[model samples]
Target: MADIEDEDEFDDLLELLMTNWRNVRQRKMPTSSGADNTAMVASTASTRKNGGAKDDRQLAEDAKVEFDMSSGDSENLPDEDEMEKKVPIPGGVDIDLNEQAAPTIRLNPKAKKVGAPRKSKTVTQAGDKSDRKWYQQAEQGRQQAGEVTLRALADALAREMPSLVDTQCRLSGVIVKFSSAESKKPKLRMLKNPVVTMDPFYLLPPKLLDACMKVLSVANTSECAIEVDGSQETRTVAKKDQVETVVIKDVGNYSRKQIENFVRIQNLKTVVQLGLELHKWLTIEGIPALPAKYHDVANQVAAQVLETYPYTQIDCLPALPDFTFSMLYRAIPPTWLSDASIRALCVRLTHDFPSCRFAGFQDAVPHKTRTRRSSAAPVSREIQDRVFQQVAEEGVECVLLPLNFHNTHWCCLVVVVSTQRIFYYDPLNQAVHLKAANAIAQHLKISGLQAYDVAAQNNPIQFDAFSCGIYVCWMFIRHVVRGPPLDMSANALPRRRFELFFYLLSGRLLTREEAEQHEAEAAEEDEKMPAPPAASNADEEEDVPLTQVAK
Candidate 1:
């Protein structure tokens, strides 16, 4: 009976041990904390005092049992008889049940259950305790794992002292070792977690640590077979064998080569801005006088262009004749308009509406021309010749010329040669330049047309300071089409800017319906896209990790 009782108690302990092992295997080790570091240090010190040989022996025994259980090789596991011989008796007590008188076992008063049924715990209370226990056990297991890994590394390094070859050890999918040779090369290697810091190095003698580093430096870089002990199995890993990672390069929110036209339009503003900046830099030695407040705006614009633009070259888009990037930049809002861009728009307008004749910046002279000291000496014959040269050839009924007043404001002048009427359009709603209107009238008369009369007409009022050129460009279209009153509201500015830019690029104006439709599509796509970080140079490639690159 005594022998049977002892065997039963041992079986219960064995059952508890097996149950603990299963729980440990199912859960992952927790991250190390301050308490974990203290626990790890204490464990490492205790391990070192006990010597490496003892730990190795214990590890070997544990590994043998664990391997047998994992591989379902029960035959290799110790039998009950062998286990009974090896394991000590529980509580260090021996019983004599055969003597017919059982010895009285003294129980500690402090440990006795003297309360009323130990007060049954509620379900929530029990669950809370279970969760706390789980966390505590996980923390303890992590410290133990870290301690064991450091011990293993030290022992391996010591054993291979003066001739350290490639060594690797993994615990629960954690890589705890890396070769010095592998680390020196420019290869993307796996990073070790719960890293053993230089604190452990101080534990070793100075001479020994120095010798270890020297040995590692002189270590051979040749490929060698190494054993890696994982949670489930121990396998041989070679240096030459590598797991490949694939990275897919994409542009904007969409995939490569599938970028939408609206997405490209969204980035065109920045491309034009940068190209203008580059051109300015080429001409001037220093930056332009645009306020420093726009510095961040320019930087952010460049970043968006780099991160989301799908093409490598800007030349992919249709080019405008006599329209440089600087001129394109001026077509956008808040930037001063350029005469070249206005001329380009006029050319396109003439192509679409052949009944009208348009004048270049030079054709209708905004500045006073040189005149001889005689009445019949052609007061502005040179200007008259240039302005009507095209109109006479085309036999057009109407002529429009965009005039720049003192190089600060943009206004338009229209002449109905057949009706003998002239209309002046000013973006600011201010009175038109009388001198400019009279100059065009004289040119028309010199070209053998009837003298024109000035007609009073109200034009759109300019709200912003720098958008006069945009308003002037729009006024020409409205007057030609005789469309509804122009929308010069704040909300319409951005829409007009985008439309004007699109027109300049495509050589055809987008109707109101088409522009609004594209804007809606762009808005939807914008909401779907995740915000990308500011990338200074999109051409610069990033070194993505193997795990993410694979995904």
Candidate 2:
């Protein structure tokens, strides 16, 4: 009975071991036949450790069936022993092999998002086909109109003031209508109170008109025209009943004296012509006259003529004439003869041709005489020799000899050929000298004269004078012996005075000592005491201090 019980117990033990082994083996085995061969071998070995009899048939079958497990199959299988090691303890504590590997979840589509639209490629048109036809036509038309207007203005100006075309002249006037039985054309008139009517045909010389036309063309192209109206009324005859009737009335015309004065004031060329004629007759009669001096007089007459008509070079001489005659006339030096005799001779000569007498001489000769004494004593010959010696030592070219006429007046006739020019000086009238200098300077194309001292050993031929008057008669004669009408206005006189003052003040014609003295006197006068104070300002208070006020 004991033997039989042992046998049974052994069988039961074998069965229990087999059952545990099978469970472990099933857990270890891969779920698919494609499991890794290494894992299958490990399962078989583990099953043997559980004390189960090795099943050769199962081993052989597993070997025969080749398993090909991928990485995913291997990751899905769990180790039986590792699972057993992680089993929950008796205290109910959970076991983990490692923190569970977090599964990756994609949530991109669930999130809110904002974005710009993608740009599409743009297509360009062929070219600019917009119409510019009207714009181009308008621009061309404007240019054409401007050109036409400019041409017409130029044509009109060419018909008027011809000289004004080429030369600079200030034009001031208005347009008016005048009757010519022949044709109709707008006539330009002077804006004077009497409405001076000018002949359109003879308004300007042909040369002047042509020049004016060219200028007008250029000006018209550059500028616009300004039209003006006259204050005077035009006389018109509308019907036969309103025929132009004239009543014969004794309205005294200009008297002989008035006419003479008018002519003298307005016609410088006429005066010059008359003087020239009279001089010529005087020369032919062999009146023991000074021809050289007369020539000088003729030149002055010509200059006066030029002053009248500055538009044309006709009748004006090309070269300057000598001014010696004008200088002598103005100086009126005392002749060796008696004063009474000289005065008598002057009266007779003037009386013989009163109309031909010079306007200047008419005013000046009456009080002058041959025996008039000079204010400054005559320079002695010895002094002159000493001056010459000194001039020679200083390398001077020439000497200026000043001749005093009346006690108040003096003159100088410089005969220095070193500069190939002559200079005249009248101490009584500085304008005459400056004009003469300017005329000579222009003619000779040489530097103008300066005040020189003829006595100084270092600088000879330089002298100081209270005043000087130079004659430019020769230049006038050379330029225009026969010319157009002259203009007589007081404008030249004032200009001459101004020029003389400017030259003198500039120290161009004065010695250092003379300039200094004149300046000192002027300063002294400027420094004089002020006049009595005027009444206080109306806005000022008596007690208020001027310094306290806001500026």
Candidate 3:
């Protein structure tokens, strides 16, 4: 019972010490009676001694006497006046007013904080170089991607690492046991998510990435095979045999013929031969591109182009696929866009009424010039962004969207947004086209246009071959210029566009006699016009890619 009581007192003493430690900085010497103050002073001294022989009262007195003589503030000890009014702590404890061995620091309890410490030197310098004003203002030889910031290319490159063929551990200081799980290395290469940091060595500069992209984009776009080193860590990728997506190439520009126009007959032939493989690909969907159920076919086509070309910029769709589809649809053997033109026959037929208005190369990136953009851009950004803004506001009913699907086929969707009506023209009448068109209508909701009303054109049999796209384009032209009240003509393919252009300028459709005379005049003009640069027959019919058409 006596031991328990002693333990309780010791616990109380420990609690007192904890309280003193907590309130050390708040140091306030409270008013207390002299007797109580003296008793607390004795207890504090006694607590410090461990099994000492001398009584606490004697030790306390000695400590007080020594401090009173040593301390400079000894004169400020509690006076008689303070003793008479002083109050003791309710728990029978009091702080000693007598000077201590160590002088207490006089802190200003009410001082306000000045400010937080400045960020470290490393942190302050971490901003990207493109964030600088000068880089953004630079409008010189290089063109910026319409919306990508200066650092975007660099960021993409940093994110893209080459897939490894064999396992080689890069991390150090790991124990390995023959029977342990750690003994085996990873079989499948897992790409680490790139950390976004300002470390200089973390990524190649944007200029370098931009240069690389342009070359790679062209290679894949043209169906020309080339090596690429996607794994930034290594300089060369040994290509004995590897999966198609990540081939290692030297870090420099490669030289290949750049194709500018589909009229360049050789390029078209080569591209068509490669494009014919797309039908096979769709049935067995896998490779450089994997087509989805709907609108994503554009990307799949772009990828297929890259895989075939082996030298395309990463996002080659904007420049490569769209151009390829446009050219492919127009350049099939024995079929050309009415005298080799991209302009619609209907546009020539009527323009006072808003007909097919071609958007310029810079129309998509309007209010800016000198752009260095990727060819395979997002469909929403490249196609929809530029759709119908000019025509819609002008209240023109018909809109022509030359949708380059899978970068292999071109399908026309005529939108009457105000009327919430959409008419799709695909001469092949493929169910896939219908599904894709519906997906497109949903996406059109962003433009404040909902294609609730949908219909498909019935005429112009596309046949089994690749003439469907061509037929689709003609249907739009025919529908806008002369249609709705149906008269199913047996044959509608006009041999010459020169007559059509003149007839359109006249603001009226040509009669059967007038059309024949116009055809004669158009043929004479063709004979007078200089022939395309002399090339062999083989070159004119060579399987060409989109590189020629995009330019």
For candidate 2, lDDT tens digit of each residue in 1-551? 33546877878766556655654654533222324444544554555555464444443334334344333443433445665565332322232212233554423322346796544434212112212543354345434423222223233433442332121121111111111211322222222232221211112222322332332222222246644368656568564422111111121122122222222222322223333443343334322322253345434443443333222221212222222121112211121112222222223223332321111110111122244544432334354444335333433443343333443333333424354334444433445333433332232222223333221111111122322222222111112122332221232322222222222212121122344666799899888967888888988867955677688
- The candidate that achieves the highest TM-score relative to the unseen native structure: 1
Q: Between candidates 2 and 3, name the one with more favorable lDDT.
A: 3
Tell how far residue 288 is off in model 3, in angstroms.
46
Report the error of model 2 at residue 197, Å. 3.2
Q: Rank the candidates by lDDT, best first.
A: 1, 3, 2
TM-score winner between candidates 1 and 2: 1
| Candidates' RMSD to native | 34.7, 38.7, 27.6
Q: Write the per-residue lDDT of candidate 3 for residues 378-480, one digit (tens) a residue.
A: 2466556666574566645566665555544556667654566766665666666655564565455545565456766656556545454456545555646
For candidate 1, which ten residues in a row score worst on lDDT? 251-260
* TM-score of each predicted structure versus truth: 0.34, 0.16, 0.29
| Cα-based lDDT at residue 409, candidate 1 | 80
Q: Give lDDT tens digits, candidate 1, residues 213-326.
A: 333323233455454456667667666533221111120011111111212222332343454453343223211222254345344433433332222222323354335443
Steric clashes per prediction: 0, 37, 50
Off by over 4 Å in 3: 1-340, 343-379, 417-419, 483-551
